[model samples]
Target chain A: MAILDVRDLNKSFGGLQAVKDVGFRVTAGSIKALIGPNGAGKTTLFNLISGVLSPDSGTILFGEMPVQGMKPHQIAEKGIARTFQHIRLFPKMTAIENIMIGRHTHSRAGFISGMLSLPGTWKEESRIRNRSREIMEFLGISSLAESESTSLAYGQQRIVELGRALACEPKLLLLDEPAAGLNMKETAEMADLITKVRDLGITVLLVEHDMSLVMNISDEVIVLSYGEKIADDVPLAIQKNAEVIRVYLGEADA
Target chain B: MTRNRHLQVFLLIAVIIATQLATMLTDTQHYLTQLTMSGYYALVIIGLCLLIGYAGQISLGHAGFFAIGGYTSAFLTTYDLSPVRDKAFIVLLSRMGLLVSTEDLYGGQVLHLHPWAAFLIAIICTIIIAYAVGGPVLKLKGHYLAMATLGFGTIVYKVVLGTEGLGAADGISDVPGFTLLPGSEVSGKLSQRITNYYIAWGLVIFGMVLLLNLVHSRVGRALRSIHGAEDAANAMGINTGRYKLNMFVISAVFAAIGGVFLTHYNGGIGPSEASIMKSVRYVAIVAVGGMANLWGALVMGSVLNFLSLRGYFGSYDDAVFGVILIIIMLFTPEGLLRRDLFSDIREVFGTGKDRGERA
Candidate 1:
């Protein structure tokens, strides 16, 4: 069975169909790209799958288990973590603190024990802190650890967001515009990090505006237009789909 | 090399204690006695710090919980009102079925409690009531929550005013003096007030330590996270609703604990015990001190209380209070205490500190 299966998924806001009857399968350990022009419902679909928005009508199965009504955090607990398109790091907190919040799910001790400096809870705190630091080092933002989020450059913030999502230790990592504001060097680093994240025995699902990054790294690509799936195949094959070319151009024109 | 934060804290505490002891040795001074009262006020402000500073919740009904605790203990132990109000209520449900005699409620005299017992009982009852009210009250956000709790404070004040048995507008008097231990039996009316002053300050110290430990723990971090972003906190697996409720209970318990001391010190209970003005004063104390900072609350509470006693602002004390809040709102919105005095000290010591750095 596929790791992620969305069957007949649909969502609407008032009279507008934000996402319509979209179906796709993400096999385990694959870099699957959901690529579309802006407002092609790419994020809306991610939101639905990640439990941010309840599907008006659909079935989402994560490893054969239907996950429709789960809360966003619950979905995260079930091994799915996604970064936001607009970069929603807890802006006031230090970057490391932001990552530590993501590591909250892993902390075992209750508040009272942790605060009282109880014996057992201290170990868990250090462990979470170390893990967060490790993720920061992995993302090459270790130097930015003590910096406030808003102070950091745009690329660094994106990396911190990735580090936060990684702190969740999810089986499937969803990247929403991870390369959005990154320069070419930073974009390459992001691509390399995505490859490394996937190599760490995790499935990767990404939505990106950078066609080069999408066309280059994605093993498979799913195309959506006007909330409907127009194509689903290997990236090379998707690159030639006529409907996708037309939709892409049509969106660019509008 | 990390600036010895604890050393600074210990030094501050040592200095305050030394000052307190020196004042006590100087004994006959009226201002010193009032300083002790200021300490008690600071204790109550700690709870306000937790609520407004840590939880980012606005409470105008904390005085209600304070009064509930104060009157409960005072009236129950001193006046024998415990039988009708507390004990009778318990018995009516469990032991005696639904039928309760109104006569059984009446002769429960109003003022005769061992101050310590009253304090403990008041705190417990206040916590329970606060928890009960907080569960529903916290579900409402922003100003709505404030108004709901403000209404509760008003209700409590009105109850205290209307109930003639509870001293009415005149308030209770001759609240027996303090006994540090169970039966040490300290005497003389003046000495009793003095003893009460010390005990109240001691409780304040205890409350401060407890609150300090509380806000540094996991729950404190959760509260801080919620304050930063409610949606983000929930998405991090925190039940925001539950945390807010817990904060409400904690804040109320603090106020109630402070009330216990306040009641014993004043040797009285009245409608003003739960007045909105009292709660507003606390809110101001927390605000001026810096929300979320315990020391801020402590220092600000003591300072404000001391100034009021001196009639520093004379007839315009309330106005000065209002003006202080406005200035704080306009100039230093994060609060005076929230600005990190430790960092300031570091800078003063010629150490280059990382200001505006968040990581």
Candidate 2:
């Protein structure tokens, strides 16, 4: 079953066609990698799917419902949660508070009830707090729960972002350059975490530039170039594809 | 976290008790009156603190809401009526257990509403107007938002100054005091000073408790997240726009409540109450108190407003606020009593290093 299906998607910025007729499908509980060279419109594609930017023309079906023009929060409520290429944690808040904000959709306390501190509000708050702690522990950053997000190390901040996304309990997780600035050991741990996320029955759609991490963990790979889909296949086949070699690796070497 | 929260609540209760005790010991009517006025200002400052400090939104038109509230109550309570209509209304009010009698003035009749009724009506009107205005105004960011709200305040001030029915430049006068206990023959003017003092402080405490509860809840976390990163908050399934609007409306309501109480307590509503300087003073108080710290806003609001009431700044109150704001912005932008500053002060005193380390 496809958790996400995009068809004939297009986006433009004035004279620049940032994304053109791009399309893909991610099977439920599968790890899918979106790989391309710089300026291949990979991030633009992510933005379209996450509802940050609307496509000029396309259809995006998260399940059976079309989510083309939905707001970001609405899409998130529909079980689609995303992390940014640059970490966007709330800087002054503790790691636990950042993660708890991810549980917003799952809770229903509003202004009046929250002000009164009703019994139901307290119950929901305790539940969210416990869940936030569990997510931090799962990401191996439980000790950083009380630390401000900006005060954390780069790798730890990335982990905190992941924990925040996971606290949403998303059916589909969008990880944009999750291992962008990590060292070798941190990249390995991130790869392990991504696999664990898939094993937990959540579909993962990743945009990454790290070839080793992509080829090792991806059940399937989709490649793009010049805002167009170039290749879509298993990782082994993508490495052997002639067009991918000429346009991606050939250009890199030259 | 829970322990710190408990300590905060205990400290707040202690402060309330101490203020009441001090009022009794001093037995100075003038001082008590000044403190009561400070309580009114504190209400406005707390709301501004929540909007600017927690939600990261700014409003320079809170005095517009304040004016609206004051004028609403003033108009309802002090409107003159014909003798026949007044007599009929008096009979109706008496049947409803609201009025004991009606007073005659200058060959005409004056029918005053129950003070509580005027207060409720003012609040409801302010809420509606705020809801209508906040949707469009809250969308602008930063300084643009401030400019837009300033425009709103200026428009309201001009309207109140030009309208004769609202008393034009003279404003409405002789507003009635709140009757403490309902359904009694006694008038609201018998123990007006002490009654108004406690009522003002009581409302201030209630506002403080509500604000503290809000900031400690899940919704408060969402607001803090919006303050830190709006896009991130939106991505996390929090509706950033809705939260901002909600905060704006809530803050406006707080200002309105303060305006109503102050108008009744002062026995008049004036154009000066709607001045832009009044709103700026509120923002200054919140900034001096420390934007995100509730206690800081409360303490700074009360102390500074009380000082002004005591004629310390004389006629240069606005100038004093302007200088204080600039200094705080340049040197201690985090606020006068920021958490880190407290720790640093302790360090200088050569004690509580363990507490500093914990922070």
Candidate 3:
């Protein structure tokens, strides 16, 4: 099944074309990597899909539902969760509480009931706590549950961010440069984590600079340069394609 | 966390009771008047605390909401409708028991809307105004947000000062007391002093319980996340705009409630109540109380409002508040009553920490 289908998406800032007529598709439960050189509209495209930035004109179908112009929260409710290229954790909150926030889509205690401390809210809150803990355990960071988010190491923070997104139990997960600040060992662990996330039957679309990580875990890869798609194929084919090589390594004659 | 919270609430109840008893024993029951007034101001502070502290939004127009509540009830209850009493609609309102006939200063029977009706109208008006204003104002960030709310306060201040029917510069006077029950009415009567004190603090207690419940629940977490990082919260499925606006309205309603009760208790209100300085005082109190700490906001709100009401600062009242704001912001942006400070104080007194959760 085509879980996400995009067609002719366009975005611009003033006279600069940030993204132009880019389109792609991801099969359900497959791992896909969006690879590009810097300034190639990777983050902009990710933002468009997550509804942080609506495209100038485009159609994004998440399981046949049009989500192009929706707000981020609305998109989130539609089961599309994302992490930032830069880590954005609630600095004051504990690790467990950060993950618990991801369960916001599932929890429904409104203002009146929340203020009144209604009987039903107690049951729901404990459920959120346990489920958030379960996600942390799965991410293998359960021991850091009570530690404040700002106190965590770089790689740990990324994992906690992933746990937070996973706690939403979304059908598709968007990871933006997940392995950006990771060391070689942490990068290997992150690759393992991505595959594990894929094994859970959730579609994964990630933007990354690490070629080895992208080639290792991704079932399919899409390459872009200067706001346009240059190639879309399996990882081995992407590596062998002359057009993708020119974009990454630059023109040899020049 | 649960046990600590319950203990504090019980301690608050005990303190409220003990203070009343102490005043009675010392033959200084008149102090309860200022205390009662402080309790009302505390209502506004606690609400603003939630909005500014938890929601990470600043509102300098809270005093405008307070004035709206005060002026609306005052205008409704004191404006004589005797000249048009015989009209069909007026007669119908009289028949429906929404109108009251009270003796004016000259001993003439003046007809007006009942205080209960006026209070309901005031709250409804606050809600409408808050929703309308907050929808656009909360879209701004930082200094822009602060300036917008300050402008709102100035507009309200000017409206009340210029409008003749709302008593103009002199403000509305002779507002009838609100009767919550047959025997218990909100008034400045000496005999009912103790009851009024409890009445005012009881409302504060209720507000505290409600806010505490809110801050510990799912909505509270979402608000904290919004404060820490709005985009992240939105992507986590928390509706930031709706939450901010709802909180703005909720806090505005609180300010309005304080205005209503205090106007009834004091027997009149003035244009000064709606001034930008009053709003700044509230923001300063919240800052000094520590922005995100509910318990701190409440405690500091009561003590400071009590001192200000009792006229300790006198001519330098506004200046004192301004200085307090600057000092708090500069010296301890984390606020004065941090956990570390409490621990340090405990150590100085040689008292062991009450409870330490494992890190």
Candidate 4:
């Protein structure tokens, strides 16, 4: 069954329709790559799906519920977690603290319980810490656990950001341009990390400009141009699809 | 989390007690007097510390709450009805279990109480008013928020100035002293002065401890996240509005507590107490201390208050405060305890090298 289903999702900024009739689906435990050139509305789609902005039209179903009008955070509670295009970790916080914040949605402790440091507060806190550490270790960034997020190198910050999203223990994870600034080695690590994330039985929907990473890991690839979905198929088919080349690669060559 | 906090508290209490004992033995009455005011100002400054340092929100109207607490206490205390007429409310509330007589409202049998009760009442009042005011004002960012809060301070000053019962333009006097505690024999000017010193210090410590715990808690983390990026914080499932509102209330509570002590410290209040200039003093204190560090806030609070009290630069103390704030903004930008400086110092001290190394 599809974990996330988007149908004719529409969003417009003034005169620019950032996302137009964009629809896609991800089967549970599969990696789906949404690829397009710059301003192809990939990031905008992420925002709508993540509920940062309400879509102008159409529907976003996470599991069985229509999640179109929910707040970004409410959507997060409903099991959709995301990372940003630019790394947006809480800069001054320690890495473990950053990941702990991601667990906030899952935390049953109310503000008073956390504030009062009640018995259950510490128990939940330790659980959060252990889980955060496990996610950090899983992403191979365990050693950076105590460091401040901003003090880390760019690649390491990216990994920690992933760990932060994973700490939420979401059913579906949306990654926006995770390979944006990585070098070849870092990108390879990112690919391995993405594979590891999928291995955890979580649905993955990602936006990337890196064709190598997209083709290597994505179970299905959807191509977009000017907010319109032009192609949807396996990575091999998307690689050969004429319109995918004509729009995305054509813009690249230009 | 609970490990060393109590030790920190004990050490703080020990330090305050030592200062009092030192003053008593050496009879450094002048220093004690100054520390009294310093203590109150420090409490208020620490309040700003939480607002500016952790929540990353700016306020230029803290003195408004300070004045509100002071004037409320002064007005209610000094207007003592004679026992015959004062017998009016006492009979009514006593039967109702409220047990409030006119005497209780206006000094009653307690020592610093008239002022103390007013201080408590004013703090509660200020929280309500601050919530009302801050809810909308906090939405505006940067200089706009500053300007809005400055206007609020000015408006408060004007209201205090216009209300003749609250000392009108001249200011209230004979504002009575603070009760050392509930129903204590700590009366008389000298005793009240000593009591005020300790009480002020106690409140300052309270503000610091409360803010420090807040900064380390999940709320603090959420506030920091919002400060870093509001949109991202929302994406992370934090209720930015609720967090900001909570911070506004917490900051107000701290300011109100400080104001309560301040009312007793001055034993009188005026429109000048809540003036825009006074609010500016608080922002300056926060900036000098360090925007993000609680200890920096406390240290800055003491240093700034001490310098002002000493009249260090020939009555240019306020000007000196303004200059220091400007210099920090222009040069340090990170205040006396810059976040970067801590890291650099930690590196030199050899404690933070490993923390930053693996990253």
Candidate 1 CAPRI grade? acceptable
**Tens-digit lDDT track for model 3 on A1-254?**
89999999999999989898999999999999998889999999999999999999989999999999999999999999999999999979999999999999998999999999999999999999999999988889999999999799999999999999999999999999999999999999999998999999989999998888999999999998999999999999988888888878455621
- lDDT of the structure predicted as candidate 4: 0.78
Interface RMSD for candidates 1 onward, in order: 2.4, 0.6, 0.5, 1.9
TM-score, prediction 2: 0.93
Query: CA lDDT of each candidate?
Result: 0.76, 0.87, 0.93, 0.78
Error of 4 at A172 (Å): 1.5
Give one digit per residue, the lDDT tens place, for model 2 in B103-220: 6556544656667777889999989988888899888998899999999999999999999999999999877765657532112253566666678878888898788889989889
Model 4 B-chain TM: 0.83
Q: Highest DockQ: give the candidate number.
A: 2
- Tell me the spans in candidate 4 whose CA falls farther than 4 Å from its real position: A108-116, A250-254, B1-7, B76-120, B177-188, B338-359
Candidate 3 deviant stretches above 4 angstroms: A249-254, B342-359
Please provide, for model 1 over B1-359, each residue's C-alpha lDDT reduced to its tens digit, 9 standing for 90 to 100: 11453564566568566766776688745666567667666766887788888888889888788888778756754554334545655554435332222222456334244456566677778767888888888888888988998988899999998898888897766455445576432223454545554565666666765666666555666678788777666666666787788778877877776666566666666787688888888888788787767787788898789889778879887777777777666545556676575665465466434433320
**Rank list by lDDT:** 3, 2, 4, 1
> Scoring model 4 with DockQ, what do you get?
0.53
TM-score of each: 0.85, 0.93, 0.96, 0.88
By TM-score, who's the top model here?
Answer: 3
Q: Please, what are the lDDT tens digits per residue for candidate 3 over residues B52-116?
A: 99999999999999999999999898888999998999999999999988887789989999999
Clashes of each: 20, 0, 0, 4
List runs of model 1 lying over 4 Å from the truth. Answer: A249-254, B1-5, B25-28, B79-121, B139-141, B163-168, B171-180, B183-189, B192-198, B337-359
Clashing pairs in 2: none
